[model samples]
Target: MSERSAGLLLEARGVGKSFPGVRALQDMHLELRRGEVLALVGENGAGKSTLMKLLSGIYTADEGEFLLDGKPLQVSGPRDALEQGISIIHQEFNLMPDLTVAQNIFIGREPRAGRVFLADRALEAKAAELLDRLHLPLRPGQRVGDLTVAKQQMVEIAKALSYDARILIMDEPTAALNDAEVRVLHDLIRRFRTPDTAVIYISHRMDELKAISDRITVIRDGRYVETLDTATTTMPEVISRMVGREIAGGAGPEGVRDDRPVVLSVDRLSTKDLLNEVSFELREGEILGFAGLMGAGRTEVARALVGADPVASGTVSLRGKPVRITSPAEAAKHRIGYLSEDRKQLGLLLEQDVNANIGLSSVKERFQSFGFVRAKAMRARSRELVDALRIRTPSVDQTAKFLSGGNQQKVVIAKWLVKDCDVLIFDEPTRGIDVGAKEEIYRLLNDLAAQGKSIIMISSELPEVLRMSHRIVVMSEGRVTGQLAAAEATQESVMHLATLRPETETVR
Candidate 1:
């Protein structure tokens, strides 16, 4: 389809939306044509979401209007937009846990067999057909809560399709998907797009956007930037536009004190279904990198080492002393800390205040044993971490949910620092962080290492694995494929090891 007005399927002009104090979208404009995949990109809270909400009718536009199929339309709510063939699959899913796949898909409008009675069998049969057609490998009768996160997401997609949506808004759909699962989702998206279907995909992974998008639309700070043909636009160019800089923060500091003593050592560590005789040493003043594909057991090893998950067998020693850790509390007692890759689920309690989350793990220690928490002392300590981490916030009392992605990460980092853990494990440390925040986080890691702290950082990005690691450990499935020093490692070498094994191997 051409870029001209006649070929366009959707035209959103001068669109704007606002919250209590924030003008979420200002003069935002977007265009999409038949059978085209448009990528919308920006840092978190950069008005990309607001624009999407307006399009999907989650929020009515404060100004301007959207024209769908040459006719101007008013969307009072999500249902209205859905009726107009607009469907949005959000980053955070909206699925009912207790509901079955079929129940969820046709929740508002279940088929009525006779006398206004629900036709459950027919609904399940129809949902099963959709699942089969989409290659979801799911049963209509299956409950959403019983399914994995990936499967639940599949249910969401099927539900959207059931709306007969022509314009599909996919907001970070692959964020929770593994590499193999991502491939499947990508294929499904491509297949689902008919001549009338216009897919708008929002993703942070530059590589995936390159693979899936036909056109790229970038927004920055509530303003429309530009739209470019995906084939003609490069990731660097897109990143430059997104951050308004040539910033690249995946590669952190290197060569962290080669002569320093090893602080954390895992000699043939084994965990059930995870670590398979994996062996690695973390130096006192080093950031050791772990590189592997998703579901390759990278986070599993981190969990086992941190005592979040139990080890089936093997040795985990701290500073040459053997330690028996069966629980996360025990791991903390040994001064070992782990930051989860999924901060929202496993790391931070989004509903709690900054000080509350920071002191959640070790409240008694941070606060004096006054029998009651020393509110004054806790505030001071939390503030110290907030300042040290450069957390962008108005006050320490702010809920983590209200904070930006970067600040929320800082709160997680602060929480661990209050524990004063000697060995720190950062799993996908900058997964969804912005460039500015990422650079700051990298520097923080460097500072921690310089302060004689041992770090084991697990990351999926190849550049990060090469740049920050004093020594790199490559894993495929559950086994360590190989280990190489910073001086000897390259992206291709690490990738080769990352894809070597199909089935999970034991690190111990």
Candidate 2:
């Protein structure tokens, strides 16, 4: 702890919380000193979010006490927390799209003339002042909808600053940002360090913690593990504590790369302003990893290949024949399926039952007979998949909305498997899934590869990319900058490729 923290800013001792079927946190302890950035780290479902919510008054702790400046404090709600100098920036931005930056920043307490009329000039001037201090190149008059995602996130931070927040909690703040934008966020965090301000930085990326945090706190299975000084502890030590075990070296199935033939080949694929000369090859029984920062066109390439997005110029060859795939239906005809990152929006129908969602991709062939749906056959197939994938559902008739994130992902996987797709593109497959479920998904991928099914896995987590990839394709600014065999790919090498770009390219 630093000397500036002699007078602590916030302390959470013996905090406990529970939900319907989950005990999220118990005997959790955390202390934040003034001017210190406390990095909260855990695997998914480790009670990090639960604790943050309690601090921001989104959820009240079932037990323990929270003290601020040596005095016990009880926050009633979000508004009360904000009034008490506590603010939280969720992963998703909460700004009104149609409003200007200044209006979004000063939404609740606007400067008014005679306390009746809106004072637009005063609002813009104050917003501009804050932006200038943060060194953000955004205008108060600019509409939030017009800004890029990174800029919109900056506006979120500016809004938090508008509240004069002394205690800030940022959850996964850099998940959507590219490398350059991440640098900007790092600078902003540096500026927030002061004698009266305390920050709780939560992220899955260890590299960011190394760059931004003064102290690191590890939580496991909703219990406090330990805390380490960022400058003194090694990364392996931190990861071991976070996971409670040392991670092995080898990632996926070995000795299958050189033997399998190329199943899908993309040559010079280009999408409108999104993908530029993107090209890759997926071998049979291989997991080809796509590694890049967000907005690096990895997802764009997947969408274009599967006909979710139009490819301006490209040739896709399946096996030995070049084919024209103009739509998802056409792609499915070729035994190709895409599991989108956002399953709720693009992959599954929330209102539909498990059987319906599973049979949707193969409705014409598998679930329909002579202009009538085969309910018995569909139920049988869905039941088989449910058992095979170990989906925790009471019945195939259960709605997709009621399933957990991991089970939902398994359902998505079942949908593709039922369609008998030979080539599968999984974008952020293990995202929002807990550690145990993540291992299950990894094992399933390995099993699929062993069965001669080719997969293209796109992940923002570099560790995941390193672990599951037989070969990695790195993209930057929509271009394939480099490719690496799994045996030779390191985090440093992958990051180097991820940051590379053409000299003429200008990043947003």
Candidate 3:
């Protein structure tokens, strides 16, 4: 091999993979040099996951080949790939929640005391040694299910490193982590870099790519686009390459008019668990953004307002009329809809068709007649919404799980719109969506506001909160620390309030 080829740690050349009626990847090429981090970025269905699966042995390529250290690489399965020093941590963790940390890490490879018995202590000791070497703050005896999302993520990293992996592939590792957690993850990644090791990092967060990657490889429509050096390339340029078009910059929300009537008002909202005397107001034709850290009770407030959680004491007023909400159905009766942060489990019905999912929320009032569903009317409405939201699907009858993340989120929005909800609560609406899809969702939210819908948008992304909110509510430790108009909200100012404790002076 040439000197240049020897310097490369891993390479995919002319790789192509396809399934029935769909070409997931074609001519996909990637390169990772020793001691560097390579970021693979693309839209939701842009073949990023396909490429990773191909590399990790979850899927085999129909054509072309992969090389490790300029040598042909072959693996029969995921275990074989790991044995060959290629370890992958998928976005949806592969951990067994019921098992302890050590058990989950060394599940099938536990040390044996003899031919029949397992050496449980030896397995735990090995796991403990590995975690200590990696500087992860985790106990081997702790139950995986009891750990926080961030700690669980660290456990995943430790498991991947346990294989003595030469090439580590991390898929959206920081997706569920807060800013502080992300910094910890980055530090770990940095420490893992060595002359004989490299990483392939996949993520949708633009800012994180700039911070962690040495080079970026962009793909679109199952085709290789270009790779750019992270140090010199602008994020906008990277995004443009991923989507094959320039994205227009959007301005922050204009301050809502004071003359607008108050649509939803909360007075001393409190829940037994987290929320404590939280309060906010939503005006007609306004977007109220909720900003906070991961555990700051932003989602708890949404749940309490929608009756998904038990409220200890509070008052909810709808257009000056007080009402009691004891369940989600009651909230719906009041025309208040909540789209959860976990769209897959809490929002969308994955097994159902798009038409069914969209019309489900309004079935009783609009699509049900004489105790039977009005299938024709429901189909008509679903089709209209599919077009209106620009939801990409072959047909409304297509199953919800078959659609991409972006389209699934759009279907959830359509459900609430069909119900004619006056007040909508969207928690992490764009969490796992691609940048292009995020722009579409942002436009949809703004359009809803223009059509006189009062929206409560909860997001951990400070830039998104600042850009899309007419007014922002900052929460810390389940309390309202401060509120800011669009003109006055900056990342630093919002973070100051986000970290403020309830014991500090509150801003009403």
- Number of the top TM-score candidate: 3
Q: Tell me the spans in candidate 2 whose CA falls farther than 4 Å from its real position.
A: 1-6, 93-155, 178-180, 225-246, 251-259, 292-294, 322-333, 342-420, 430-443, 461-467, 482-508
- Model 1 residue 263 lDDT score: 83
Ten-residue segment with the worst summed lDDT in candidate 3? 146-155
Q: 349-465, model 3: which lDDT tens digit per residue? A: 999999999998788899988999999999999999999887877789888876766678889989998999999999888877788878988998999999999999998788899
Task: For residue 242, give model 1's deviation from the true position in Å.
Answer: 2.0
Best-fitting candidate, scored by lDDT: 3
Q: Which lDDT tens digits does candidate 1 get at residues 414-467?
A: 899899989899987876665556677888888888888888998766776687
Candidate 1 lDDT at 165 equals 84
Q: Over the full model, what C-alpha lDDT does candidate 3 score relative to the true structure?
A: 0.88
TM-score of 3: 0.90
The list of candidate 1 runs beyond 4 A from truth reads 1-5, 76-80, 95-163, 178-181, 248-258, 359-362, 367-395, 404-407, 502-508
Candidate 2 on 26-122: residue-level lDDT in tens? Answer: 9999989889999998876678878998998989999999988878989999899999999998655778989999999889888998868999999
Relative to the true structure, candidate 2 reaches a TM of: 0.77
Report RMSD (Å) for each prediction in the order shown.
Answer: 4.0, 5.2, 2.9
Give Cα-based local distance difference scores for all models.
0.81, 0.84, 0.88
